[model samples]
Target: MTVVGKFLPLLGWVLAGVLMAEPASCESWVDLNVGSELQRPNEQTVVDQTALVRLNTRYSAPVGITLNAHYGLAHRVRLVDEPGTGIAAAQSTGADLRLWDLPTELWRSDGDTWVIEQNLDTLHGVFYWGAQEFTVGRQPISLGVSRQFSPLDVVVPQRIGAQERSYRPGVDAVRWRNPLGLTGELDVGWVFGQDNLLFARATQQWGTVSAEFTALTLNQAQWIVGLSTQTFAGDWGLWQESAWLHDDVLSGARITLGADRSVWSDVYVVAEYHYNDVGDAENMTSDFFQKGLVTLGKQHYVALNASATPSPLVNLNLGLLHNIQDADTLLLGNVGRSLGNNTQVDATIEVPLAKQDSGTEFAQIPLRLAVLWSTVF
Candidate 1:
């Protein structure tokens, strides 16, 4: 079966959903980006032997447009379409239909409601549902402790021309939010398809803190578990998230802690530390969840990130990151401004300092530059 093999179900779901709703509002956006990157692929190492790895340099430019429409049919059903940029299989587009406030008037106590949404693409089939306020499906999941990218969910890292990794798509799942007794939420997911993979995840909150766990079975063969948390202090926001991965034949772990505090109004600083311990170093960067055991480049790092909005259409971002264990470091700065009601341009550059006797990837003189233009209405 090819990649399209997984899209049929999603198509049917979305079409059926659109049919049940009436179109009401529409919006669309387009993005064009081109950039160059030098990537280093890891290889087997031998003691007393030197393995020289060279960077593979390349450039890519892609254009994508997404158009979405919402319909209010019978005051309960809504139609939606989220088409793709058609550049790559990983980022293909799709559609969906959502039904809200169905046949549960008695169960919808004051602040409670029920809804069901479905996607119309085999590559992304989602069965949406919820009770009193909780909903579940095979949709993409983003949890705590993440920056430009997520560390706990490190399955895929690049979001350029097209998607390249497997997304925990919409699946058979259940979620109950602020149920009759609980305060935060409760979710259970059991997914199975093509490759015959199974996954389960759950999350809850205590006062100002939230925690979660996720388990997955590969090809219905190996099992892995993860634990994570998020909280806020008096003047700062803090988080500690980690995963303990174990299969019948392998075991590994990863953890990251970060905090942000405001010094004054509209100005703040952020810092974080990430650690990894992978028994097989080769497994590093397999997925978002498997950073392995050693922080890639074995880093104890911190960053000072700040941003400001000088006008309605202009903004700036700056940050400096340094690794404590190695002499590796990164200096970042970027600015973005809107050109029109629906179009904007932005550029960013990352400059790396030379290594200091410590063999770290960031210590090398690595540089990345890029510009992007996006528009929507």
Candidate 2:
């Protein structure tokens, strides 16, 4: 269907949700963002501009029902023949898991410069009883504990290089949560549509230490067993998460060890090491040519991120990713200033310290700069 045709049904749903609840009991939000990115991997430079609009509506009552929905529209214009892997799809495991083949791309300009896409990112109903909560419909399901790399976030793994990491795209799923007293909880989720998946996790805390155990199955295919823990030692925060993945093609473990600390007020740093044994890096840049690749090329890697708020309204951050096996590295830096009024602006740059034509992992990533402006009301 046309983009407009597909979006019509979503608009109706959003309106119906708002109208279903008393005006006083309804809550709604809208977010608008405009982002521009420049890539200069080689002599041929490219510029891409994207504008996104999101609408979120929720209705809750003490006795009746609760409904929530989210919708988004994005318009993008970029130079033709440029190389890029869609960042949105990269951040979403559900990009490959939806049962319906409904593509979000609405339309494209004749000259290949413009693409319009819209998605019903969230449409879920919530039920609450005492300390138990259940959510059904398409919703966001994020798992795991690691920051840069997540071994247990099988449902929607965050991309390591995503510029905007505030939101996770929703997948068709059902989730249940129950508190096991004040220090622990049991969480479960099931996803369907493209492929199916089921997982359950139990989390408990003791003193300043916390731990989790998870078991997950990929419908008819793979199984994952995971364990993770985090604790504080005096002034430092430490964490480790590891998972064993088993499938027809591969069986191995992915592990991550991380630490974070604040040296002083307004300054923080994080370091992590990731060891991926189950992924194949044979074709290192497969996604560079084709999109939607689910593989880890280099096995051993390290990531570091540090940020400092110099003033009440200004911030600076730096990050690094190094491939231990290949000696490839990527350096990242960004600056941001709060504009007040629930709005912000940020500029970021990434420099890959390897040759773009090399077989090494980070080397093939191009130099990129991006600026983003966003507001919520």
RMSD of each: 16.3, 5.2
TM-score of each: 0.58, 0.86
lDDT value for candidate 1? 0.45
Question: Tens digits of per-residue lDDT for model 1 on 194-215?
Answer: 3333445567788898877766
**What is the Cα-based TM-score of model 1?**
0.58
Question: What's the count of clashing pairs in each model shown?
Answer: 34, 5
Q: Could you tell me the TM-score of candidate 2?
A: 0.86
Candidates' C-alpha lDDT: 0.45, 0.77
Error of 2 at 53 (Å): 1.1
What shift in Å separates residue 270 of candidate 2 from its native position after superposition? 0.3
